[model samples]
Target: MEAAFRYREREGDLKAPYEHTEGPYPLGRWLSEQRRTFRAGQMDGERAAELEGLGIVWDTADAAFETNLAAARAYYRLHGTLAAPRGAAILDVQVGQWLTNVRRPGGLGQDPVRAERRAAALAAVDPDWNPAVLGWTVDWQRHYAYLAQLLDEGARLRAVTAGVTRHGEDIGRWLVTQRRDWARLNPEQQARLTALGVTPARVVRARQAPAKKRSTTTSGRGAAAFEAGVQALAQYLAREGGGTPGRSHVERLPDGSEHRTGVWLANQRQRRDRLDTGQLEALAGLGVPWAAS
Candidate 1:
């Protein structure tokens, strides 16, 4: 036991796999701890390389914005209300403020809708990359509230029309006709109805706003585009007046906001292999490689 304690002093017990909760989150915790050590000037060159090889940063950062939204959504479900960012709670104020600041206009801020869609697209591309999901869950209470009001109106109308032989077919037909109305709805109204499970089906699905500039990563072309983007950037950077890409970049979010990140970050190799989808496309647009040899 004494020897074990001494050995633990020299090397921590974190090398083993964690029990119970096992996924990217635990791994992300380890990665973050190692990063803290590196930041505090504790990691040597080889150790740093090993940590880099784990590819934790690339995955975490790529998923970070959306994952935070997912966790927040999960919080709302368990807690029975939207916390700080979305809700008007005092307890969740600091937390909510932090969330707002984190996903502010400059860089990757919290956007659950876009995150979910991108995650869905990623899952469509490769199911293995599926992260913790918080989906478009329904609020039956709101649906009931709306339905109750409508039903009351129906009752009043029926009482007035009792002299005539009338059926509720008109109401039923109107309700189902909402399917046609769904497509005509603006995005927010459709979203509200969707949340209430009252949205109707339509032949035409709303189209996503196109990216102002073409992004190869979002495009369906697979490895070929990635390799070509890498080659393109390499060629562009090698030409003249090109700098290794700033970690900060201009990104267009789903809300039609063009956000430019304020902070510059390290160029982790794993990022190229993982998070490089959007970044590479941005670089390709600017006609330069992110990192040139």
Candidate 2:
């Protein structure tokens, strides 16, 4: 066994070293020093020799050093910061390009609001694109679409406000309050608008459904009972007042006081420990009354 182990160890020692798959190992902190030297138009003979010893090759010794030094200087000037220590600088270059594309007049434009919105969208899509810098990239087409959408919305809002004679509620505020009414319109309502060749402004108003009247008896009773149950549960949890054990904590006495008592008791039990699925199923099977409101 010892003789076999010795032979295996010798075989392992003779194996070739692992080859680095990618070219141009990152210069990292050495980049700043390299840039300074390049700006001064000088090359370090010792550093060039070290890189060559690590299996990096150049057509000629002086050419290799000059090429490396020039590249380092160019990168630092563009980024205004160091490239990530370990990876290719390709991503950094792409981010720089994306920044430049957004700043052009026809790009995001000089409008502060639109520019800010575009910058935010670009940053969200690609965080490496510092919006403050100038650069260009193909990925900026995505940000262009987003900025276009914002401009469209702004135009629509302006048109809506311009058409409205009343200024009490602005277009944006009215849209927020009426969102649910706008969502609930039927297919027939939508079809009628389409048949008339209706404008977008008319379509916005057409989508709103008529408000329904509230049920005073059922809804009011259910709401009052639920509120009483909540108050009773809070009092029980806090262990407050010298009140009767089964009495609800509501200020107003309910019309059907017995029903409120049942709700309050159930709430108290729920507060102690929540009901399990099996327990809930058992209670449901027993035809226990549940509030509709």
Candidate 3:
């Protein structure tokens, strides 16, 4: 069940609609079967024990579902939709005041709805009553609240998992940036980058590298080439260094005089085999420094 939850969270969109093969099971049929099984208890000791365990598990699952359903219905009754825009507005107002009380700058500084109202008044003789406009504002607030909730949950989970102080805003921003970058890249590129454990920031920084300004001097070209070579070496080291012994490994240079050089050479070789010059240069410039040789 845990594995199923993870798979749904990670790859739900990728799954085919009809991949299950079997049609949906009827809750009524399942319940009837359960009732029969419970009535036939103690017929076989192993079967009886299994049925008893299943009953407990089923009951727990049903109770959780019921609790969640009741919460959803209550929320909808109070705030119109599950999105809970009015609730979100109240939350935003509370957050703003809370920040003011703490003497810290809060997001947007004032009520977002008031800002929208002021904009509408300036643009027209009266406030806009378009259902679409009103709906959009509500939707935006709901989205904000939904995201805040997700961030809060994620922070709690991460605090437990990583045993670190919860930094919800930083983590939320990182997640948003990562998702934006992932959305920008092709699936193949995303997969390759993910496989290599490369992050979106690294990719974005590589893309934003200053254009290689042409150098007029021969020495400048040499410096550039040397820099390029150094970068290549670093990549080689990263690819080949630090692993269990007897696997692909870097041998230390004698007297450690050119240890950096040796490491760079190793890394350069690996980078050459693994990537094109353009890719290598980009990787190198993104702070993948070559070992001192």
Candidate 4:
């Protein structure tokens, strides 16, 4: 297990909290002593910090991350497949592995967003092929789809179940994410799936559904007022805070009217969480920066 995996440093400097802990905060200048401290993404921050600031000097963060990956890699090695059992609730396991960026020394790491892709690829392959490489087009995280090298079209599969799985919301649902993918299915197949409330159109709508409605605080507003409120929030973000307001951060002006920008900025500073890509893009469209804290 140790031979197949080793810790690799993703970066040189450590980030905040663990960035410069002098055995404590503020006077953490002693962090430089561990020059090779492995950079751990925000997976298990407290443990990562302890590993770096306490014992395990060199490659501390990477060691912690790699050690965890060893277990998952063992499963993959034994199965020659990364697929979990039919009822193992596979996505949950994938989420845990991805949180720490687990990977082989030079191999691609797990990504939560791409769980579906990996799952689909695994579904595309035949159970007979184990540990086969160089098949699918899943880029680096190729956990499945490795097949025989023979050049025979007779062994090919016709539109196997790549996206659809017997899972929640997706249970009996087609894997066709976009409406166009429906072309792969014949009219009989389409009708059979639709009868079970699992059609390509339904899948697209489910995936594109908007988030749950806002809290009761804003539930009274009509559609027109909702648009106005969003526009006002955007303009305020552009003018005052320079960033978008989050659920926690928000404030009221001197006149007593709640100002979304002011409060969002305040809360953002109080809780130093990073904004995701989608959030940053939305703020960019409004001429506001993505600065959270």
In terms of TM-score, the best-performing candidate is: 1
* Candidate 1 to truth, TM: 0.29
TM of each candidate vs. truth: 0.29, 0.18, 0.18, 0.22
| lDDT (Cα, 0-100) at 219 in candidate 4 | 33
lDDT of 4 at 180: 37
Off-target runs (Cα >4 Å) in candidate 2 are 1-27, 52-98, 101-293
Scored by Cα lDDT, where does model 4 land? 0.34
- Candidate 2, residue 278: CA error in Å? 63
Runs in model 1 lying further than 4 Å from the true structure? 1-20, 23-25, 58-73, 76-95, 102-104, 107-293
Q: State each model's CA lDDT, in order.
A: 0.39, 0.35, 0.35, 0.34
Comparison by TM-score, 3 against 4, better one: 4
* Per-model tally of clashing residue pairs: 3, 4, 7, 6
- Model 3 ranges with Cα > 4 A deviation: 1-170, 176-262, 265-277, 280-293
Can you write out model 4's per-residue Cα lDDT over 1-293, one digit (the tens) per residue?
11111111322334322222232243222332333343434336565565544334454444333333333444445434443232221212442234222121112324543443333333343232111122111111122112111112233322324542221223112233313345443454456445433446534344566655432322344433333434455444322323345655444433455545545544434432343333433433444443412
In model 3, pairs of residues that clash are 233-264, 236-267, 237-267, 260-292, 260-293, 261-292, 261-293
TM-score between model 2 and native: 0.18
Encode model 2's per-residue lDDT on 174-223: one tens digit a residue. Answer: 33322323323234433433343322333434655775543232245655
User: What range of 10 consecutive residues in model 1 has the weakest lDDT sum?
Assistant: 130-139
